[model samples]
Each structure stands twice: as structure tokens, then as C-alpha cells.
Target: MKHLSGKLFISITAYCAISFSSQELAAQSDVLDINEIGNVDISTLLEDTKTFNTIGMGIALSIAECHGKDICEPTVDEGEIGQLIETLDQRIEGVVSRQQNSEEELTPIITAYVDTKEKYADYLERLSEISKPEPELPQEEFVEEDLFTDEDALTEDEYSAFDDFEEDLEDDEDLDEFEDEYDLE
Candidate 1:
């Protein structure tokens, strides 16, 4: 409850500050007091107040963000801002020069890669052409391959051995006798 009341009080205070400032800012948008030498416009005073408020809020947010860490404040000093800007300018120039140098250095390598890629594509195209199935020959032109040629004739001795084996198996009487000896029934 106490914390809630505290937050509510902060909200009210912030609201009042913004509301009162906005009322003071309801004049000519041009805050430059040109041509009038001494007197300043009410809007000019409000704008200056708003600028200070914004800067203060920025500092407050930065401090809050680094609440628990070491080196809580901004690293830059009031005097070092110009030096930091100069250092950044030098670094940007260095980066641009390095990019140009690298492009010059790598040009040949990039050209070689492109040439090799084209050559590889051509090689693959040739492989595809070589791998296509050949067209078949017409049936009239196709000849069956023969297993034997002119020197495969049978010999005279082989024919004589076959005739003798047939003559020896012509005894049906002896064959019937052998059958009768083996029959049990």
C-alpha cells in the first residue's frame, strides 16, 4: 500500500509538470527572439525548460540502466567528445579503404571461381551426352552370334566307339535272364 501510494504521487507530480509546461508552450512555435532585443517569449522559456528536462531524463535513464555494475557513468568526458568523433571518422575511412583494397586483391580469385564453375557445368553436360543409351540395330541387319567356327568337326574314332557300344547292348535273352534272377514275386 505504501509503495502504491508512492508510485501514485510520482505519477501525479509528472502529470502536473507536463500539463503546466504544455500550457506555457501554447504560443508561437518560433522561439527565436528575432528583432526584439530584450524581451524573451514565454514559449522560448518553456522550450529551454523542456530541453533541460529531456537531458536530465536521459542521464537518469543511463544511471538507472547501470545501477549494479562497475563504471556506471558514460565513458566519455566533456573534453573528449571531439577526439572521439575524430577517432570514429578515422575508423570509418580505414574501413572504406580496406573494402576497396580487398576487392582489388580478390578479383582474380573471383574470376577463377566463375571460370571453373562454367568448366564444371560443361563437363557435366558432356557426361550426360555420353551416358545416353545407343539406338538398337534393325532386325534385318542383326546377326545371331555363332558359338562354333570351322575347326569343331567330330573325329572318326569317336563314331567307331559309339557303334561298338550299341552292338554290345543287343542281347535281349541275357537281359531277360538277369531280370528273372532278380524278381522275387
Candidate 2:
């Protein structure tokens, strides 16, 4: 009777120990982030999946390392390795679908932006052409008459010299006397 009791005690303790270990391992598994949940755009998610292929490979390699020598070749049906791969594939597919849908939805918006940019460029070109200074009205060719007599052709310095000469002659009485003495009429 004591042996039977001892066996039952051992069984219960083993069960509890197994249950605790499983729970601890489950807790160690990755959980999705809440911030990631809200800010997930399609393109970003697809990019993430594309980058995650490396991680997926790493995980598979780890599984292989752990179960490489296991009995019965460790069929995926009874293992988590194949299931993890399948989950990754499903995640990639979901991301691809979302990316496709987002691209389809944004097509018009992208087109509109490109069209607007082209229009603005054309408008700027036209404005630049319009605002450019035109060839100045053909300048008239200026002609100079005889410099000795033409007042318009005389520079300010030349005019002032001529005025000074005229004043000196007016002040000279000899010129007046000579003119009167030589008069025969």
C-alpha cells in the first residue's frame, strides 16, 4: 500500500513539473506588439516580411540543430518546426495581399501627384520665358554734325572754353579800335 502511494505521489509531482515547464516555455515565445498593430501600413508590412525570411531561415536552422538526431526523423506533424515555417509563409502571403491592395488604392493619388508636378514645371517654364527681358527697342543710331559749329556736338568743357574766349575778346578795346580805324564806309 505504501508503494502504491509513493507511485501516485511521484506521478502527481511529475505532472505538475511538466505543466510548469510548458507554461514557462510558452511565456518565452514572442508576442505581437500593440504599437505595431496600429501603425502597420501595407508596404511596411510587406517589407518586414521580405526581411524576415532571413529570420525564418535562422529559426529553421535552430530547429534542425535541436532535432537533427531525434528518433523517427521527427515528422513535422508532431513537431513545431514545419508549423513555424507554415506560419511564416502565411504571414508573407497576408503581407503581400495587403501590399497589393494598398498599391491599388494609392495608384490614383500617385498619378495625380506626378501630373501636378509636371504641370507646375511647365507653368514655371512658361513664366520664366514670359518674364525674360525682351531685346531692347532697336536703339537709334546718333549722328554728329561738324564739331566746330554744332552746339549739340560740343562737350561742356569745349563750350566753357568758347565762352571764356568770347568774354576776353569783348573786354579787349584794341579789337574795337581796330575795327573802327579800319572802317572805310
Writing each residue's lDDT as its tens digit, candidate 2 over 1-185 gives 99668645644554444345335434422331322322355464434333333333333332233332333221112234333344444443444444475544544323333343343344334333332224456444344344356555778898899999988988776677887899933
Clashing pairs in 1: none
RMSD of 2: 35.4
Candidate 1 global TM-score: 0.22
Model 2: per-residue Cα lDDT at residue 126: 31
Q: Determine which window of 10 residues in candidate 2 has minimal summed lDDT.
A: 69-78
Question: Relative to the unseen true structure, what is the C-alpha lDDT of residue 165 in candidate 2, on a scale of 0 to 100?
Answer: 94
lDDT by residue for model 1 (1-185), tens: 99668645645554455445334433322342232212343344334435334333332333333334443333112333233233324333433344375543433333333343343344334333332234668986766566456566557997788888787666655677788999832
For all candidates in order, the CA lDDT equals 0.41, 0.42
Model 2: per-residue Cα lDDT at residue 35:
27
